[model samples]
Target: MKNRIWIVCLACLWLVNNGVFSQEVSPRSVFSLNEGWECRPITTVSKKALFTPVTIPHTWNTSYSEGTILYDRKMMVYQRPLEITNAMKGKRLFLYFEGVNSAAQVFLNHRTIGEHLGGYTAFCFEITDQVKEGENLLEVWASNAYRTDILPISGDFNICGGIHRPCHLIVTGQDCISPLFYASPGVFIHQENISEKEAGIRVETHLSLKNKKEGLKLKTTVTDADNKVVANSETAVTDSIVKQPMLVNRPVLWDGKKNPYLYTVTVELYDGNQLKDRMVQRTGFRYFSADHEKGFFLNGKYLNLYGFCRHEDAKGKGSALLPEDYKMDMELIKESGATAMRLAHYPHAEPMYDLSDENGIILWTEIPMCGPGGQAFTGLVDTEGFKENARLAVKELVYQKFNHPSICFWGICNEILVSDGKKFVEYDDPIPFIKELNGLYKSIDASRLTALATCVDQSYYLGSSDLIAWNKYFGWYKDAAPSASKFFDDCKNTSKGIPVGVSEYGGGASVNHHQWPLAMEDRADSHFHPEEAQTFCHEGNWESFAKRPYLWAKFIWVFADFPSYMRQEGEVDGYNDKGLVTQDRKIKKDAFYFYKANWNLEPMVYITSRRFVKRDNPLTDIKVFTNLKEATLYINDEKIGTMKPDEMKRVIWKDIKLNEGRNTIRVEGKNGRGFLSDSCEWYYIGK
Candidate 1:
């Protein structure tokens, strides 16, 4: 009878594995801890009531109206408890958080397990040891009380509290791959001297493995498009420990636009003949360099850089988005004719790196030290606090994202080293801090170039970075609206030998929604005119805002505004309407169309702004912004004539006729440095 029972159990297991019980299992599970959370003053907690209900992605202080709030508020403490059951016993358990504002201390079953100090960057801790077979308790204590030691305490943007992102309890195999590791197993490249047809190809492969005790083994086989083996090799490892420096040679070459060849590298791990894990990395073979005197080069060919800064926030969800959202953003970025993206103030969601790797978009990833403020503001200065936070950010960012081929630059800060009035005290020189930060970045990721954004004149700090990038608001933030040409000239003149680029520009605009006549008085601190600010409130129009700058190949900063609590009186409460799309993700503003015209590289027509068309005006004069140097207009296929835009903001196309039937107007612009086109169709009743 015991033998029969064992046989029945084995049969049941087989059926379950083969889908007989598939309906009972799922690919993923949602564990929502949004409810049953509570918060109280930190001073009120006692030993007996150590655990309390608290909401995640929450902050300690919600009282500040605007500006930086840097006071020690120990009175407020947040707590949350979770109960775990036996189903989570043997499996590897991971507590994953998208973000925990400021610093957090976590306890499981009354024992301290893990702690994190950074507000951004996703982190996880294994909790299997702390949990029992039956009921288990999880407690978290979060503090947003300001500390001079924290790096972001001095910068712009509100340190909103609570778990700003979703939390998850991941359960996987003991050897499951880490969520953020580069998915590409490894990359191969072939670099040939242009003069010599017989070029040597180099192959490099990387893998994230578990069960290192059994050792990792790499097996590489290269084949042509026809599946014919051209070369192959195998490496055996007797030890499982991962060495800091891993290297492999003779990789296949990946070239930019001219010769976009790529090779595949396959790596596998083994534990005494038992297959442990496997991964494949696709890489290209090419050695490129960027220089102050010569610009950027790839495979010995000189190329200009054209790109934009991207934020991770999505419509409706705020910053809490899934992998698909990142993928879609990349798709639109690629379609916009941008070859690169600066991940903005911080390292972006992990999936962004994967998309950049696959799509070949160059990346400039940076830490969260954005805007101005330093020791003067937080009394933190360049002390241990700054060093520790910088070190942690660099280590995590490099370790998790270094392998992506698309990552070409690592920025230390975005205009933070300089002293702005917002700080409590001022320093005569910011060069020392800049040098220290740049040195730290170089030490961490020697493979990538280092850069920073400087709002103040940085002639003295130019030597600190490999490339000189400045976020000049001469036209936007500052009162002086310098010509686009003059702006580039100013950067060049100030940079001297250093290669200069405009990292941020463009004014904000709201879409469809006209600014309240009182908006100017209400938002006195805004950089652009009320009408211009309204134009950016939609999608596509923000693209137009980026056009003139892209002509030089190094301008970015076309943004879809991020949500911030730094609102002044008379402003909208929840959303910052300067984004290409509204916070809710509806309405594509006029600037979005301008960007689509310049970046899409296709013939398209879009309406920029309708404000000029008053309620009583039936015929609205449209200002079509195109990257095309020369254009010809055709209405219903009838050749209208060559067109040129005049200083008065009108495109001249003489003697064009219109009819009552559905009519189409197309204008094709000549492509100079970038592509540009636009069109419009109107129905005529009787005139």
Candidate 2:
């Protein structure tokens, strides 16, 4: 017993010498603070508000039902209780907001902590000094009101209000990786040089040390997909920043949709063998470039980038999307065999970038410095605050998403310049601002390319960025269906040696509306949107785009329908119906299969106008979109004729006689793989 007491005394002395019994702290503790919140709209500062329980991924602007869309462009207050336990007292704390619309000011225990401007990107605040021991009140004031100083002064899409994303509370040791650097991962793995033979990488780590102790070290390790350690380095953390160099031999490239290779980078902070913090970042090595005449090349191989534009707004959720929604969208996109996607007009959620990385889809992410469509021009303001906010937003976007390999183009602006201006055009030239944004992006990340989208034939803006694309809706708005093909010719003639692309095309389509003979007389804003006209417009536009390999990229207007408070077209009000898929993602328009047949390599067939079950003419054309070499049309179980697919993968049998009553239509297609057939029913009334 005496000997045991002596050993215990020695152990206590050793523990006291090492300071282990003083206070305990973990490496990093992160948890979602997405529940138990109360929100209330603030109409006026003097009026008292009634609070309602709400979730984090929420938007007050979206009308989930069939009522009028109440765009609540007002301030809202969200309050929740943040408990600080005794075990978490000594550690540093941080509050991270993945997204908050327009602007937000955070308060802890009725004291102002921090504020952030910009809706799309993320922001973080160090709350180590603000919290108490027990339950503490955390409040956020978010507003989506039109701010001249903020970006997206006016846009085609809705600016949703409230915290429309996830929130998290992060706890870490006094010396750990800093999440305050533009709300980034604080560890950036830079690919200095990459090739098949060797890859030179540099890992930069940003640190936050409250008690700067001597003998602090930073260790960076890189592991391949198989969890095999490829490279590692240990360096002394002299300052708040540490740089470690590594080299990988014969690195596997991240080929688009072919081999999406990834490498895991782990960064750990240590103080004399005691770990303080750890962070993990995923990275891939690939190089890409766009040739003015030869199109885009990825990793020294030619690749055709054909895909669709995407918006964050959905039917009921508006811009408040969950991870499952993102996954569903990616599954649909990948199923279509698309190689790229343009995140239109603004930066999307972080999960989207991750999905793009995982799915090997190239991305074009931009800021929401959108201009008015048509002849209006009120998107940009010529104020110092506005310019500064724009610049800050660009910086935040680049820094936060710097590590994603899927992002190839940093789109500066969208339609910032139109044909005519309602206000003073001299004050908003937008060329200088565009050039400044391009330069700023190059200054931060010169590895990627800069691009911008325009709506007019302003060749002067072509020199502003490395690549330029145009958003033209000639078939729908200009009353000329063939102009969709002619627009690319005009672009080719006046491209001035810069890589050009078609950023936005295709018109609105309502599945419930069908026209026998397609007509282009209907305007984009009209209530009568025929589904056949949209399919015809896409057919013409895609054919033209396919013929011109010089066009570096081609992105259809949108992949899925999204809510737009400014719209009242088609069957649905307050929504943009140009998506290949419906707003609720329940149906895919006929145009979706047109691209799938042209792009996908799988053996699949789809009969066009399947939703148009009633026919007015007894004699009609049976069009089928299939990847097979030849397809034969059948009516009432009788074969009509066999025809090969055109260059656009469309097989048509003209003047097929249909039965007067109920007619069963089927198309049997064949390629080298096998045979597949699609059937549909059409009721025909003899003319």
> Which ranges in model 1 have alpha carbons more than 4 Å from their true place?
1-98, 142-145, 160-266, 277-286, 373-380, 417-425, 428-430, 478-484, 494-496, 512-555, 567-578, 611-621, 626-687
Write the residue-wise lDDT of candidate 1 on 1-687 in tens digits. Answer: 999999999999988776465442222233666556566655664756654454453444443446443323343444455667656554566677766666777778778988877766667777767777655666666665667655565543445444555577766444433443321122323232321133344444443344455444555565533455555666665433222222334434445433445555444444434344444555444566676555676656665566677675665444545667777676667655667778877777667877777677777888776654321343125677766876677766665565566777887777655444554235534567667778877775565678877766676567887877766443344333334456555666667667766666555554434432213222335433444443322222223324433222354554555555543311343334455444444455566555565555565544344442222222333345554445676667776676664432235443334555556666666665654555566654443
Question: What's the CA error at residue 5 for candidate 1, in Å?
Answer: 34
Per-residue lDDT of model 2, residues 1-687, tens digit only = 999999999999988667566342447999899999998876545546568899998888776234874476889999999999998979999999999998999999989999999999999999998898999999999999989988888877888888999999999999999999989899888888988888899999999989887889998899999999999999998899899989998988888799989999999888876778999999898989998888999999999999999999777788999888999999889878899999988889999999999889999999888886653447788788889888988988998999999999999998786324553344467788889989999998899999989877657687899998988775777656566667777777788888888888889999998886565775677888887888888887777788788888999998988877678778878778899999888999998999889888988889988888878877777789988878888888887888888888888887777788898989987656677999999998766
Q: Each model's number of backbone clashes?
A: 69, 0
Using all chains and alpha carbons, the TM-scores for the candidates as numbered come to 0.70, 0.93
- Error (Å) of candidate 2 at residue 272 is 1.0
Off by over 4 Å in 2: 1-26, 44-49, 64-70, 375-377, 418-427, 479-486, 671-674
Leading candidate by lDDT: 2
TM-score of 1: 0.70
